[model samples]
Target chain A: MVRYLSAALLVASLFWLAGCGSSGVSFNGKDITGLMPDLEFSLKGEGGETVTQARYQGEAVVLFFGYTHCPDFCPTTLTALAQALNKLSDQEREQIRVLFVSVDPERDTPELLAKYTAYFSPRVDGLTGDQETLRELTKRYRTTYSYGEPNESGAYLVNHGLAMYGFDRHGKVRLFMRNDQPVDQIAEDLRALVSIQ
Target chain B: MLHTLYGALTPYIFSPITVLLFLLAVTAYLVGWRRLAARGRPPSAWRSLSFFLGVLLCYLVMHTQFDYYSRYMFFVHRGQHLVLHHLGAFLIALANPLPVLAACAGDRHFPRLAAVLRPVRRVLFDPVVATVLFVGLIFFWLSPSIHFDAMLSLRLYELMNWSMLVDGVIFWLVILDPRDPDRAHTSRFGVRFLMLVAALFPQILLGAYITFADAGLYDVYAICGRAFAIDAATDQVLGGLLTWIPPAMMTIVGALVVLRLYLRYDSEKGG
Candidate 1:
């Protein structure tokens, strides 16, 4: 009975230690830490400056692929992320960067992208590139995109991946946030990511 | 956040057929209970309670957030399947409402009601047929293409749910019938034990395949997208694990019960 009690105490202490362990990042999104390969990208930012994974070193980065014309998912996701970022303290918010990569280069120019992202939050940067560059980046990320057939008015829809990835301070893809996650949960995840360093 | 989650998870539409079926179950139970009491042979409280609980579960699955959120999350969808196929079916079978129902219908002349259902039962309630359907429909509905198609169409989704419920009830009703004279004459326990064993492997294989797959199987979740974000791959894996573990345990429990019954019968005969 003493031996059993010792074993139980040992187990309980181990659990307690685990509960108090490093960087208590309870991600609301799927934890893809070390499961996914390092995400690499180079695109033109809203200000026409070159943007790469290295640019946001030492900060938690959020990357999304969407088009400006997307009727629902794109705006909703951006707004939710904005709300989440707003929930953070200014210092914590400074540790996070959000990149909205436009899948529709034909319409979402650098200026347009800048305007669109600015409407959400100043911290959110809009990124766009030529079709070939965008394709290459999306392929590396395992994201899908395609242009729908043009209508009579010559307007077409671009359907792209509705997911976003979160990278920790070390620049490794650590979380895959679904399109349906609530705003506050996203804020919690962002807070955890901010403390990663 | 929790309120928003709950709101997103609540059922948006009522399924007319499911509601109709639930009403029928309640009416049948009430009529059976009353008739049995009038005859001074009231159905056992346990049986009545089990049947009522089964009907309630059936209603809950059809009309609650369980049904609503199934459209988004793979794990929730698997959960819906488990509730319909296992727990609800088991309780309904244990209730064994057929005799009571017949008593209600035929004014205590259950044989007359049984005679009316005889031909239909002989064809549809064959143990072998039930076993095949019980196992086959699980694979059929869960196959990626079919599941994806069902998600896209409300009609197909309803059909899938109804068929699973019906097949589950039929399979359990046949296997768990304590007083099926035909089952007694035949070595039914041995057959049931074999059926239970046979049902385990295909499910395990399917579950493992889904669990370990590199990519998500269903495209509907990918295309339509969820309201809150969960990684499709991770959700698929969790859903697959859900399918794998619980059903296997249930089958094992069922097999153990069959074995115990077989042993008891053998020991009694030896004595």
Candidate 2:
């Protein structure tokens, strides 16, 4: 009985290992279909109005987490995203929404977030929430954020995720865009995402 | 102060299953220990302390705010596994709580359940199977793609942790069975030594690979964000070292314990 059981376990593990090989439509960005939960959040929008993911039910949503005080990666990533959006056709652009969720809610008020996002693109909408709500949203995506120690001037930095999550029109998670991904490739992936039924 | 303490003690992601299983185990052990003491066969105080301490360490790492850092930081994740799969599990198995646990099982209740589980336990405890599982799990989870997915999915993440703890306990139990092989028909000491040595080298190699790699191998930590502002390379190297050195030392300690057991049994038979 022991020998048979061990053999069965061996075979089962082999099958599991074999199943790890992924195959599908290849994109420059990592394909995350079914790997993450669907897009969902109830955050405070630019005007202090409550915004839920349900508001963007019929459009593709690209979600990013950062702070207005982020001096480097946040602006660079947002600019790259803006450039990517510029490459898309007018109608294609209309089908996508870029959400810049601020993780440093203490320093990034809704008005500041709105202004910061406006400098990037019209497709971008700024969002922030209370720390608890932001924590829940980040945890749902398997991401996290932390604040660094304040400097003598009371300035501090908030570290956050450097990837963008793409959700389809029907709110299924589809793509994982790394911060290092090229703008044209991001655009191409977004175009493909837009065409997905 | 009390409120802050409570916040730190609370689980970052509460798992009812973990809490329930831990409660059941502690309750059974306590009940069985008292029963044995009444019968004049109580385990030593040192053994009891080891058992409780082991369980407590595992619980603190798994159920407290420490779990949050493990999720977001590479080095903390390695430290968590080190406790689960090496230190904590090692202490629990070294305590040899089997007899006490069996006392709880007794002759009256769960006979059918014990009978059903006997074959499964036999298979898991087989020296070859135990060694393979002990080493294979490390490699399987550390594989970059699998690591990425496991860290992302809550169910898979929980499964990964629980499997490491379960497999670690089983492997150590096989090595640290207090019974003499000749009389108790337990696994041979030589075979147990072989299992320890076999499990050691692959871990060393994997650790070295991660530590020496120029580029960051685990992008998941970066993508998900880290717990602090430490460099990614520094975190990876620290995690690699944690994976490399302490576990190898534990294996050596385990072998020495096995050698002592062998000598004790030998002298008992010869004298």
Candidate 3:
């Protein structure tokens, strides 16, 4: 009777003691690992060159959907991405490419988009397409965007999704990193995604 | 120049009410100690030290960079929570300042004060009451609406922090009284140990929910923009982890201490 009670108590204590220590690799972002559908589409990169998911084979690709004129979200996210990428070694940095897809294709011409993205980091490539093509591409990812009516200056803002998606070397969507994550954490998640075979 | 001044002074900005309240507590403790010495019943060195450390930590958590950063970072906020509740409360309970205060009030006897405080103390220190208030306050503040709203209003934020500190002191005092003269009403060490252990389950459950959550629970942090540029989701995860881990370790240590004390008492009694 005494032995049984002691054993039972010990087991119960263990249950209460359980937690805190993670049993697996803890992710800083939502682990949509292997959950997202294949990212397949061809978009026009700078200089009107066609860019496809296949082009980034054997390297981790990061995609952000926003316009260059976004005063806060786009510039902040791109700056953070630049800092996060800077934390890595030259070799590790080479294995990653950041693509900024401008939702406001009307104003974000190929040249303007290229120059804007290049200002943040050399590894960042600006991707854009015409209205229908951009709409279809965004639709594939279940992303949303809406253009406000032009103001007194005949300029309008495009509101769009603020999430960044990470694809592993095999082109599988692994990270759904949010815009607010700190640079170090994003860097850590990027490192993990890049390490994935 | 104004921006630079504001930036430099932001971290040291302490609320007038908080400063006043803590200063009053220090005055009471000091006056109480002096009275105790005059009566030839000076407090133990350890208890005095423990109480002072607790008060110091309270000031540090509230007035320092910790509080300033907690306004921005989830993990730092969680750290502030831990200090206010577990460590500060534990050390203050070890000090057990009530008797000292009573002594200071009227040279070891404050009949009028006792009349008012006695019943209040009885209800406040009841084991079940303490546990419920402590645990309920934690969950109440952590609730998405309250947590989110608290960030928007300075008064609500102060209320949340103060309540946590008060309830923590109340809860820990019940478990760590050291001399429970009313044996029947007070919780025994074994029972207190069990209660602490039980508290860990819900705490860990909450932490896991936050850590593994698919979406951000506190939208204010995201809306305000993370000052550190920490992704909101990542900040939430790290905060959840901090909430889950340190409290469990503290509780485990507390339980072990209780168990050891229980064993020592039993052996001394030859039971």
Candidate 4:
């Protein structure tokens, strides 16, 4: 009986240990290392050319999903991201890229996206895709987006994810930053993520 | 139009294990029902209907596009668990499927399989173990940190759902066993009643805690975005109500069933 009890205790402790597994680097954001798939998507880039995850190879990528017309979350989060990037050293900033993928392909053309993303930072790229591609990408990441009914003025709301996913240099998913995280903490986490290699 | 309907009906995440288990169960039940009918000992239609409805409800929640909403919305996830862990499992146990399943097995094939499963069943069906698992799983998965991880990881998410489902079936089966404890050595009806009541309070406490909390207990839905635009607090409250009310009602319903069983057994002995 004692032997069986010890075995059960050992097994329970092993599960507890497994549940607490981490990547050894702390961040203000939720550590999601190995919990999600590597970054991958094919979308229309701001240059009117097809772009894929391959273009961002060898750089840390932050991916956020929203509509260009998102009145609050999009602009606020982008601004916060810009501020976070400003806190990083130029050398650290050089290694980071932020991809803002608009889910409203009908309204957000490449030119509009380019202008919108450029307002934030040169390192930020705007991309949008057809509904099918967007659905696939969002589903892969276990997030989703949906458009609301258009009102009298032809404006509609597009609900999208507020958290940003951070991928390491090798494109392995590593962190998830919530919209409420502070700019300084975001920058600190980015700095730690940058030094992972 | 048909294409859109088909897309909605198709599974959000297909699992062969789930499909196979469901198919095998349906086939076995049908075969056994036919055999029993031939023997003039068929179960009541209501019981069979309960079994099929229970199985189908579980399948629909886990396999259909409903799963997508459950993943992205807190309230829907709670509803899915309500069906899986309470209503669906309750109906299935109420159907008393063991006799039908045993008839299908017929003591001919898979003796070794039965031998292997016997010890496993013994451990799982222990009254204490069953009660702990039934309540503990709800608490375990709803822990904010664990809930966040389960929502993110596909494998963990699947495990979480399947565990709740399997544990629910085991727990309800223990409580709703049709055999008389004096004759069949099953759990005493009083013990089953205690298990139901024991499992009830923790759930009520947790649900009340979630409902009345000032802030969102689960951030995964916000992080992943919702199926539509709804306030986080509203969503949490709805999820909390789902967690609180229906399950407590199910516990009462289960207690009533045990009481009826006890009364029936007492009369049988007296008469």
DockQ numbers for every candidate? 0.03, 0.60, 0.02, 0.53
lDDT at residue B262 of model 4 (Cα atoms) = 92
Predicted complex 4: CAPRI docking category: medium
- Encode model 3's per-residue lDDT on B50-114: one tens digit a residue: 99999888778887656756765677888898988888877887798877877778743588888
Compared with the true structure, what per-residue lDDT tens digits does model 2 show for residues A1-197? 65657746764774373333222456788777767788989999999999999989889999999999999889999999999999999999999999999999888888898889999998999999999999999998989999999999999988899999988898888888999999999999889788777
TM-score of chain B of each: 0.87, 0.97, 0.90, 0.95
lDDT per residue (tens digit) for residues A101-195 in model 4: 99999999999999999999998999999999998999888899888999999999998888899988888888899988999999998887787
Q: Write the per-residue lDDT of candidate 1 for residues B24-101, one digit (tens) a residue.
A: 878977887887898899878999898889878877777775675676567888888887887787778778888777
DockQ, Cα level, model 4? 0.53
Model 3 bad stretches (over 4 Å): A1-197, B1-13, B180-185
Kindly report which residue pairs in candidate 3 clash with one another. Answer: A180-B230, A180-B231, A180-B232, A181-B230, A181-B231, A182-B230, A182-B231
**Ten-residue stretch with the least lDDT total in model 1 chain A:** A14-23
* Clash counts for the predictions, in order: 6, 0, 7, 0
Interface RMSD of each: 16.2, 2.6, 13.8, 3.2
Clashing pairs for predicted structure model 4, backbone only:
none
Query: In candidate 3 chain B, where is summed lDDT lowest over 10 consecutive residues?
Result: B220-229
lDDT, candidate 3, A71-154, per-residue tens: 889999999999999999898899999989997888888899889998999999999888887766664443546676789998
Residue A56 local lDDT, model 3: 83
For B1-271, candidate 4 gives per-residue lDDT tens digits of: 9999898879987888889988998999998888788889988999999999999999999999999999999999999999999999888888998888877876585476678787677777888778877898899889898898889888788878887888899999998887899989999998998899899999999999999997678988987889988889999999999999999999999998899999999999999
Fnat per predicted structure, each in turn: 0.03, 0.73, 0.00, 0.63
Lowest-lDDT window of 10 residues in candidate 2 chain A? A14-23
